[model samples]
Target: MKLQDILTPDCTICAVPAASKKRILEFLSSLAAEKLVNHDTFQLLESLVKRERMGSTGIGNGIAIPHGRLINATKPIAVLITTEQAINFDAIDHRPVDIFIALFVPEEECQNHLCTLQSIATIFRDKQFCKQVRQCKSNHELFQLIQQAS
Candidate 1:
């Protein structure tokens, strides 16, 4: 699946003031919860947190792909965020992260999950694309940048 398939303009946030990794996850969870009917914010936070316990999703280059599986989810949902300042996320490269892309997928779709993650990673690997994402000053511009990506 493509990012546009799961991500909406409303789910993309820019210049967020979250100061810590936990707070970033909380913000993402709450944003995602707004779009997910009947989903609990606490439960969504738990899912993302549970995955982080296994390993940091912080993939370095100031980016983190925090994702989780939801048993009750019917389709994947993605939330993109750009922080006003970088925060420690336990990245492999040991650098702070400022860009976050949180994903929630149906628990049963393992293959789809992997594919989606791979797609996101591939896009993020482009330094120019990431630079543009970081340069965006508003939510609409950020969402447009992601949607217009190749």
Candidate 2:
């Protein structure tokens, strides 16, 4: 699946005021829960935290893809956020992260999860694209830039 396919303007937020990694993940969980029916924000947060405990999703260069599986998810859902300030995310490169792309997929769709992660990684690998994402002034602008890139 494509980034544009899973990402919507409603799920794209810009200049968020999250001050820490945990707070950001909580914010993401709440946002994602609002979009998904019969989903609990705390449960979603647990899933993301569980994954984080295994390893940080931070891919460095101010980007982090925090993803998890949900038994109730019927399809993949993505949320994109940009913080006003970068926060420590325990990234492999030890750089603070500001851009976040959180994903939730059906627990059974392991292959789909990997493919989606690869697609997101490919898009974010472009330094110019990451720069454009960071420069976005509003949620609509950020969503538009991602759609245009995809």
Candidate 3:
């Protein structure tokens, strides 16, 4: 699956003002909920939190991909956010995170979920892509950057 297939401009945010990891997750959870058939933010948030308990999704270099699987989800949904300021995220590199691309996939789509994660992780690994994303000034700009990058 492609990142563009799952993520829409409507689900991206630039310069999001969040102070902590929980707040960031809550915000992304809200975005994910908007696309869910059940519209249950709490359930999605719980799944994300549970995943974090197992291990942080922060792969380093100022990025984090907090993700989870929802049993009732009909398909995958993704949200991208750039925080106004970096926040500690327990990243492997111990650096604060400013970029977050969160995902919620249907529980049954294991292969698709893995591929999507791999795609996102690969994209974020590009220093130039990460730099361009950080330079975005608005959600519209961020959305355009993602489209252009793809």
Candidate 4:
């Protein structure tokens, strides 16, 4: 799915004030709930955190893509956050992640999930594009940036 389809204006946050992995996940989950995602935000956070335990989703360059699959979901959703301070993610590049793009996909949508991830990853690979997202300071601006990418 396109980032624009899943990323709502409310889902895009600028300057998350979290400093650790758990805090980051909690912050993101709260955004999902505030966005009216149809699930227990804390449970979703736990699943995503478990996934992270298996392996860090931090893709380097001050970015982290924490994601998970859920049985209750029928579609995918994205939550974007730019932290006020960088947090350690145990990334391959060994860098702190400041920009986070979390995804939640339905258990039945494996192929779609991979495609969505590929699309997000490609969009993120463009350092300039990622820089633009990082530069956004408001929810409206962040949604616009994501829309432009799609």
Q: How many residue pairs clash in each candidate?
A: 0, 0, 0, 0
lDDT of 3 by residue, 5-26 (tens): 8889889999999889999999
RMSD of each: 0.6, 0.7, 0.9, 1.4
TM-score, prediction 2: 0.98
When 1 and 4 are scored with TM-score, the better candidate is: 1
Evaluate all candidate structures by whole-model CA lDDT and list the values in order.
0.94, 0.94, 0.91, 0.85
| lDDT of each residue in 79-99, candidate 2, tens digit only | 999999999999989999999
Per-prediction TM-score to the true structure, in the order listed: 0.98, 0.98, 0.97, 0.93
lDDT tens digits, residue span 59-110, model 4: 9898888998887776788899998889898987999999899998888899
> What TM-score, to 2 decimals, does candidate 3 have?
0.97
Give lDDT: candidate 2, residue 101.
99
Worst 10 residues of 2 by lDDT: 34-43
- Model 2 residue 39 CA deviation (Å) reads 1.0
Model 4 segments beyond 4 Å from truth?
Answer: 35-38
RMSD value for candidate 2: 0.7
